[model samples]
Target chain A: MASKEKVAIIGSGLIGQSWAMIFVSAGYRVQMYDNQPEKVITAIKSIVDQLNNLESKKLLRGNLSASEQAALISGATTMSEVLQDVFWVQECVFEDVALKQKVFKHIDSMLKCDPILCSSTSFIPPSQFMGHIRHRSSALVNHPVNPPYFAPLTELVPSPWTKPEIVSRAKAILTEVGQKPIVVKKEVPGFIINRIQDAIFAEAYRLIEDDVVSVEDLDAVMSEGLGMRYAFTGPWETAHLNANGMTEYFEKYAQGIFDVQSTFKPVKKMEGPTAEKIIEAMNKKVPMETLNERRKWRDEMMIKLSQIKKSSQ
Target chain B: MASKEKVAIIGSGLIGQSWAMIFVSAGYRVQMYDNQPEKVITAIKSIVDQLNNLESKKLLRGNLSASEQAALISGATTMSEVLQDVFWVQECVFEDVALKQKVFKHIDSMLKCDPILCSSTSFIPPSQFMGHIRHRSSALVNHPVNPPYFAPLTELVPSPWTKPEIVSRAKAILTEVGQKPIVVKKEVPGFIINRIQDAIFAEAYRLIEDDVVSVEDLDAVMSEGLGMRYAFTGPWETAHLNANGMTEYFEKYAQGIFDVQSTFKPVKKMEGPTAEKIIEAMNKKVPMETLNERRKWRDEMMIKLSQIKKSSQ
Candidate 1:
């Protein structure tokens, strides 16, 4: 049998480790590279530990055993060694455009094969950094939501110059590795997920600013209300289900919806007394010291939710 | 044992039926009234069947047996019969200002006791209909999300005339019955939940209109990505966890968030070709003929999700 294909993971941060795990679980050999050799070493150990933990809980991805998947992930200190013989490169670097551009330029000159190059940026569009890359056609943004293993949505955003086939190849590989990939037709700032998220944030800020609701109650609006259905359906699908169909939904609610939309206050910077109030409330609910514990709880919940979603499917 | 406190449900539609089930599950005797008596009779039978179904799935809300809860619900054809000696009146009438006004006016004159009056209007504020009622001070809006039994978020919106004690009483009762309640301090169109929902809908519409993403892909962005975390945490809490804390999150992403928010096009009416495209895409995904099946599937997923949430807690 042919040896398993290879994928390179740059920047051995939390996201990079997650990508390594996702690829390795699907039987792909992952070479995780970080500028600091010690960080890469630490990331590999953490990845292995997490895989085993997930296995003990019966939440490990793919059909591979935890040992098998862990065996496929290895760390490299050198960029050349990491990129060698790889079919895909997942760059999980910092969110700065200039830093990303510099990395892309460096990787561009070293690449021997025309492997698909994907950036895990949540905000910056590919066009900003992919402009000077030698294999620009192979470049695009494959931004994943944080903790991509549990939350599988990845946005495949192609630059204007990126080849269409590259996006298709990346999408197929991502799907094969257990991801839900959505193609953003244009290189919009914030891509799709953050755009929608920021919209929620902006409105949430306005609601809090106007003193219409408290911070805790505002969050409850989503977690207890809209977020429940959203876990299974999208906004449009939700509207479709709420009424007879999409057509009838708009016919009945378009006016009321439009009227309410018009009432939204202009977006403002999230600072001042409102910010202080929110920080105080959030600290009270999930103290800064317990942030790590709360995050773990969140990840566990996501894992359970993903299992529920899979079984339902 | 003392007699169960009586609560009146003034509509026999889906929302009313859900309210009845919720009240009955908590050991409150429910008197369901409708202008059309046949609808009320049918609603009671449907509610009974639903309770049994939920019981068989181990997803029933309260400690009471399904039979006991079902036994507590009965139909009333007259306004006086439903309102007599009741401590709470949940008015789940049609979302018409004039009609709600007429219903409130009619009930106002007939009420011998000053029961806390709540309108289940998702859009209209209480002030719109409670303006002329004699019991205006007791009136407020208690809007529940669709399929309220499964999705437990309700917005308690008070009009200018509503008494502070009434809001407190309503909040306590809703919490006791296992529903999440958020108070809207001021009356605004769409209150809290719908306003947030409309913000999402507006942004989603803009994305589709600009051809940035398709209907199906846009939905996946939520169902697969942000929605996962949202099911367990609210927007502010999510931001807090995403970074070191709320302060750090703002320091990192507030500018980027503001940039994206500023780029959002002004909200427009949901009409024209974009609507047609969405309608076609949704119809293909969930055919009009299978909408009921799809809705059942959504509700089942919500039930399972709620269980996951409960277990995690």
Candidate 2:
């Protein structure tokens, strides 16, 4: 009634629940649909519970209480029902391409009008799901981070056929909410975040395999050296800020980067004394027995950090 | 006069000043030393000023205010003068291996009655400088992050011949001074942080070279995507939390990582078309004309982030 945007989330899994949290927190009237009615209900309640946790931690920005937070929930029973009134539908179902084909066929049949339908798949190509759809021009991927109540990055990946108008509208809506969304001009496996994460993980794995440093030592490099800078800036910006400017840093050190990159051999599977050392280190630092407890700690820390950002701003 | 530990910081450069802030903040009397008498005078005033700035930002976690903070600064004209009766020495000077060799030779000669001696060299390995020293067993690398006053990670790298007691002592002192230190059992170039940073950078650089993503989009992936998550959890811990457990997660996906690793080709140096694109993106985002102002912004943000970590803890 207040000109609020309507959002439909398909597949109420962990990522779906996070999407629900993000859309709800960003002031969208969210309708989460799952084939199983129970999952949608669970996702909604779980999202609400996460909101309450944020409230309790004083991490939710802007002084909204748990009771005040409950008003954003709106539910749906079917994909048809979700597409009935929504301006956007984000598909977060499993990553199986065949299953996506089946689901997209069904959604395509129901999508009589264009409403910027987007997939939330992390690894799958957008071509798989959108290629066969009748309204393929409106479909794309809008991958989001997990536990979206704390993390605030969203990737707006568009298929080639996706209309520029639709992207602009989606980008506007995302900005109106609090999340930072960056449009990926082309779709690729792992989108942007996962791609970057995967690249770093490969070398980190190789470093351990080479017995260059322990896992904890590797983490320290991030948490202390690069992580400290990265949490505030990106690699390009870091290069830019480190010296006379990024261009100069590049000019001075481009050859150095090439040499380092050249030496990087593909990592084989984790093996030998290294994997055992990592497992031992992890068990000592964060035991399997206390994983749930540690996860809780992590969530709490994330909540507090988000709160810090929200309040400071 | 109190029962607190005494630590000496040799060389009054940016790294030395940062170490002083860290030591003072962690409740230690910092004896700051520089070869040049003028540098000692400049460093004391500069560090005191920085402490005042930290106080203004509510970032300083130490017990001392700006005025009394000056009392903690014991700037000595010589390394031997500052190392007198101290429990440990953290040397920060020129990064040249030759300079480090000459300086460490002097430091080892001074000896300071068997105090743990460490260098803040970012690149040079500890063994290269420590092998010839009489007090070699007591020497290792205790490399603190640039501006450790704000960023709390310290890497404690020990050479093969280094004594365990010296490692423990350095680690303990680093901890006592509120640094998050990760011990490197094996030393490698760029160590842990730079290696990972270098790898990600190489990949990102290639993306630009391949004409896949613009510089802004590349940075956006981190600033918005995985970076937001990384601000909360390290990669290893992230793996641990993503699945039921770390070991299970690694066991299942180590092969995928190996596969991805196999696909990675070392990046060529940035030249030709991509360089122009990056220069365009960077010039748009940050005008080179305002670099000094931007540096201020970077330092301010670091201070705020550091303060946030302090407050949360």
Best by TM-score: 1
What TM value does the first chain of each candidate achieve? Answer: 0.98, 0.90
Q: Return the top candidate by lDDT.
A: 1
Prediction 1 TM-score vs. true: 0.98
Those runs of model 1 whose alpha carbons end farther than 4 Å from true positions after fitting are A1-3, B1-3
**RMSD (Å) of each candidate, 1 decimal:** 1.2, 2.9
Least accurate stretch of 10 residues (summed lDDT) in model 2 chain A?
A: A61-70
- Provide per-model DockQ scores: 0.86, 0.52
- For model 1 the local lDDT of residue B82 reads 94
Q: Against the hidden true structure, what lDDT does model 2 obtain?
A: 0.74
Worst 10 residues of 1 chain A by lDDT: A1-10
Tens-place lDDT per residue, model 1, B241-266, is 98999999888888889998999989
Pairs that clash in candidate 1: none
